[model samples]
Target: MCAKKMTYRDALKEAISEAMRNDSRVFLMGEDVARYGGTYAVTKGLAKEFGEDRIRDTPLSESAFTGAGIGAALGGMRPIVEIMTVNFSLLALDQIINNAATIRHMSGGQFRIPLVIRMATGSGKQLAAQHSHSLEVMYAHVPGLKVICPATVEDARGMLQAALDDPNPVIMFEHVSLYNMSDEIEDNTKVDLKSAKIRRSGEDITLITFGGSLHKTLQAAEELAAQNIDCEVLDLRSLRPLDHDAILASIRKTHRAVVIEEGWRSFGVAAEIMALVMEKAFYELDAPIARACGVEVPIPYAKHLEDASVPQVPDIVAKVQEVLNSDV
Candidate 1:
């Protein structure tokens, strides 16, 4: 297979471009997405290539534009709605959870919302508390939506197409920290929106995570390798319909697990995974399942404080070692 190296931003742009080229129904609408080339520049040059009608720039109102996207999808258009950041997405919560997510079920299958909402999420750029937290758990908690966090270049490039093919709504989270991440991906790379991928295989412990935290977890695994602790890194690509089979399989093999998340510890995604393990794979555990999550507070603005608030490489390594050395 032919491979090419590109930044995560470029991969996402390629996905959007391919989708638009293949389907006339596909169009993108969001703030600064057209003329300003997007806040992150992912949509740069796309406006010119696709024309203003296809690549649209909207008002500052998230709710207004998001509702417009939903209407477009219901009217047989594959509308991609870009909420500049996860924080701004809150304004569109009613439109998203109420309209886009529920119209299909409310209409008793008569209506299907083929909406794709893309948002830049997570911290690392020092954008401060308002612009920074990982709010994926809120979206994942909803039953009618498909929530996905693409952690790799292949997924960043391929998941958009998969989402567009689905009959319902899909929410795609692109971690702000990963925009510059570059890697070699196959030209034929295919991505499924439902599977969890095992990036690194091991038998000692499973370091379960997704999105931005994936790289940090991988680095932690590397550091742990020197101490003879083999860590398996499982990327929970799809947060909504989590691949329980893959998660359980990893835990059953390792017998010890440490779930990692950038969200706050209380009632976070890690907690849900931990509960699942306890119920289905309780006997497989050699030690209590552990979690390394962000501190329960607004994300700080200062670089050092922000770094301290979330789970870092050292934190993950220490948590893994703690689980390994536990007598319980």
Candidate 2:
């Protein structure tokens, strides 16, 4: 496999093109996916290569197009549906929850929805409340669906193929801020979706996060290292079926845990992860688990306010410090 530095956007495009080339059953459907080349340009020029039939574009009807994607998947095709953003995905919630997620159980295991839904998520770019939000938790709450957040360039290139191969529906959340982020990745690397990955190894404390919050958590780890606090960073790649083994193992080693998320703390993904740690690894903890999360308010349009609403690098560092300082 060839290794080269590339932006997250290019990596996603390569993943989609590769998937389509390898599987004749794979096709993409969404608003502006073809002529407009996708909202983030991840599918740009794919239409020229795959043609309109495979790279079909629809009007501004998320529910209709998403339902069509579900239908296509049920009809023996692997369909990749793109909802413009997480905010817009609400329009297609019925199709996703009622149909795509429940088809197997409802049909008594007679049908499977091998569909992959990709959407831009997280708060950044000053897009205001409507366009910016981290709602991956809502999707993860569902029992039958699989949710994955590709926090790195390697994952951005590999997770799509893995998602397509799954028998159940998979929701892929791509942080908008990461589209321009660049990293070195092998051309043909395949990422497994079953487990969380430890981004850094340490013995003092464990920092757990995913999606846009991962980089910030890693930054916090770096700063903590300078302060003589060795921190381990775990990227929770798959949210629905969380890597419980990896989480417990890391917490067992470090004994101190800090969970971070771009979503609000109450009932957020962080809360769920914290619960898991508490349930399974409570005896191993040296202190109470800490959490850094988004503010419980509508995301503001102003740049500074937007930055304040979500978890930042400084917030993560401060939380980790607080956890370390707390006495059992």
lDDT of 2: 0.93
Q: What's the distance in Å from true for residue 51, model 2?
A: 1.1
Residue range 1-328, candidate 2, lDDT tens digits:
7789999999999988988999999999998999989989999999999999999999899999999999999999999999999999999999999999999999999999999999999998999999899999999999889999999999998898799888889999999999999999987788877789999999999999999999988988999899999999999999988999999999999999999999998998889988998888889999999899999999999999999999899999999889988949
Clashing pairs counted in every model: 0, 0
lDDT at 99 for candidate 2? Answer: 90
Cα lDDT of model 1 by residue, 1-328, tens digit: 8999999999999989999999999999999999999999999999999999999999899999999999998899999999999999999999999998899999999999999999999999999999999999999999899999999999998887789888899999999999999999999578999999999999899999999999999999999999998999999999998999999999999999999999999999999999999999999999999999999989999999999999999999999999999946
What does candidate 1 score on TM? Answer: 0.99
Looking at model 2, report the run of 10 residues with the lowest lDDT sum.
186-195
The models' CA-based lDDT, in order, is 0.95, 0.93
The positional error of residue 177 in candidate 1, measured at the CA in angstroms, is: 0.9
* Candidate 2 residue runs with Cα over 4 Å from true position: none
